[model samples]
Target: MTSATETETETETATDAASRPAPPLIYDGHCHVASTDFIPRQFMEDVAATVHRALEAQGAAPPLARLVDAYAAQHQDHDADALVAEMDAAGVARSVLMVPDFSLRMDCPLTPEEMARRHHEIRLRHPGRFWVFIGADPRHGADGIAAFEHAVTQYGFEGLKLYPPCGYSPSDERLFPYYEICAERGLPVFVHTGPTVRSLDYEPAHPMLIDRAAREFPGVEFILGHGAVTYFDVCADLALHRPNVHLDLGGFAGAALPDGWPTHLNRAFRLGLNHKMIFGTDWPLNRMTGGLTRLVREVTEGTEVFAGVRRREQALILSGNLARLLTRKGNE
Candidate 1:
């Protein structure tokens, strides 16, 4: 019943739509793209070879060499274009790039000025695909405040990345000014919570520390990274009760999934704490494919009636929640 001109138009529209890329499943909320100095070349090579062998051992088809080469590029140095290509291969759309500490001590080797420059360049390169988090060392005193301001004002970072108990403590009143500035700008602060190789004491891993900060800075949105690991229940409680608190399953959830991990995830979900969860892989520290596969399997296996809930929740935690949180006040 259609005319020849109408048929031709419809065909062109269908072809155009089909040419679009598939929507990404993963949006890594937290990751680090740092100088290779923090990670030796040999160590990265070993990890790549390990991934290669693991895939081969499973009888999985060999991945494209271009994919492997792109991922390996992340190891040598920070390249925004290479990272974007790797993300595409990994089915990740966006990643929040954070500075890395050589010793996992929260003290960065790069000066604030250098960090600002790099942040600007990365934003220029990737645009919406990459977001910046400013690293602040309270030990720098007034200089630290200046650096933080520069990162926000000049570099246009949306959040602050802190490793409390590594460089300072949540209870330290000296860091109040930094917190105040974040609250004023409505910047989110993601604090590293969970066991860290750098921590000699366990106090830093406690969820209670974040609880206090949430109470003190009601204006600032606080993200407790790694979900306080051994203190997941406590973190969940805080997230459920506090108006300004959320948690990210970065390394903790992935590391916990192999044995009886579904039980913990189910418990967290049943507690009505699903809205507070976000996805992260602690890149250069964890692999995206492995982490995502584990999450999908564990969540899907954990429920029967909630199968749809599981899928929706995974999508929310993996990307939607992050999009909402990051774009709360036009930071998107």
Candidate 2:
């Protein structure tokens, strides 16, 4: 294979259509602070090897320090100070932190409660720069609901992070109570819509189920995470037809790299879903610095595929849209 293309640094201030700087302040709408302890062992080894291979393919010997930093970043729960420091470097003003439900999939030491507690502590310490999405395995039943309520009422978590791959489904009757709580509290529910590796129940993480929840709870807002991964058309349909449903582009850009997820996002733009789309980096899995660049514009030239989208619309997707949701929810 030919050499991998060189990735451009983000110093260039001009774009193809206009001579403007990148958005001054971005809000990373989705992020995960789960430590390396959360990742399954074999997967860690696989990731390390993949990085080594990529470096080798580029005709450079992978430095041990590079591998060390890669492993360290993913292996440790992010520190609030460090996260904010990265934000300063990336020009990100705010970020939405998310915890994952590893109860069924990994041998994680921290229970959902402990994880949420840690995340809450960070949000409190960091204040305005960080918000949180509470995650749960509703399969834990009544106990899970109680913990969720406590997180919302006691700690003031702003959103719900549902991991259907953790032995549950978005359309399950058990989730209705949780969805109802979100509706009542003016919090949006974030559903993992699309395939997820490292879990047994990936098949049930569907966009259709999320759409059903959006339909059933019209008062509640549902944001499909990962842009429905491989279910772009379905996500676009739901976001277009259902005012309460939206999508966040988190892990998709990194997962699809190079050309990025243009076809899928371009479809959303063509259908006028800009206001419904939120920018996210799925941090650690993808870093805020470079990952965000590929998603918003061409790495080398800063050309965006959704050329017809106005600057204000792009700005909204970067931060304004999610800020609007947070504001509206606050008044509700």
Candidate 3:
């Protein structure tokens, strides 16, 4: 019944609304931008050569440099700006950057001070785009805690990152002081809880150890990174029981969901644990586009297949829920 001009005007308005940027609401709760430096040209070349030598051992083609070059072209050597560009393209608004395991390097050693300094610089350059998690090596004893305290006080770090079993186990009494400090200061603790490629004192990176910490320190917020990938059910059980415990869907979110994985996600949803589930891509290792797409698809499919879920619930899992949790209380 509308005139042609009126209809055209309405269409233009709708187009403009659609073109507006999607809510700047995404937060990559776990990532490792600092680890890019570890992937130097020499290291890549060494890995490539090793791959080629192994292949040649089996009478296969020797394409080491070619493969290395391809990966190198896709991602440069320790270029954070390029990472930022990739995040912008993929609609990620912010990333919580964590330091890599220091023990891996025999040379170019990274003490806690050095790690904190780099994080401060990165935060200064990127502002709100990058949030830092101070890395504390329990092996350093008192010195590590002092360094961690400095980072938290000076850099305004939001959380602490621990790679237990990388240098020590979560159950070790030596690390309890650090956990106490975090709890007292009301800072969140993010612990690696999955299969780690690097050599560590412990293997499998089980969530059970972390569960003990959760029970011990109910005040400190604990995030089980990778959603305790190999321990999703255990993580779900923890989330159900512990109000302060949360799960970070970092690298695991990008991978295709297994046959029973959706059930765990649905169980968390049913238990009203949506806000505790955060979105993270573990970028550079997994492209933001691929991670976001997989999350969107899985959440959408889960809602469709499950009885007590809706598409809006999927939106909560992707971004809305995280936005609420990450923001300080009363900000919402």
Name the top lDDT candidate.
2
Positional deviation of 7 in candidate 3, in angstroms? 5.5
TM-score quality measure for candidate 1:
0.73
Instruction: Give the per-residue lDDT digits (tens) of candidate 2, residues 172-264.
Output: 888899998988988888888776654347677878877677779998888889863457788878888999988888776656544566655
Candidate 2 clash pair list: 36-75
Candidate 1 C-alpha lDDT tens digits along 83-178: 576576566778888753223443444555676687678788777788887777677779778878878888788888876645567646767787
* Model 2 spans > 4 angstroms off: 1-23, 37-73, 257-259, 262-267, 288-301
Give the Cα lDDT of each candidate: 0.68, 0.73, 0.66
How close to the true structure is residue 272 of candidate 1, measured as C-alpha lDDT? 66
Worst 10 residues of 3 by lDDT: 100-109
Per-prediction TM-score: 0.73, 0.80, 0.76
Q: 211-309, model 3: which lDDT tens digit per residue?
A: 677878887778888773457788878877888788887765444566555565565567666667776767665552464445534544445323585
| Model 2 quality (TM-score) | 0.80
Candidate number with the higher TM-score (2 or 3): 2
Q: Give the runs in model 1 whose Cα sits over 4 Å from its true position.
A: 1-25, 37-74, 100-109, 198-201, 252-254, 257-263, 288-312
Model 1: weakest 10-residue lDDT segment is 100-109
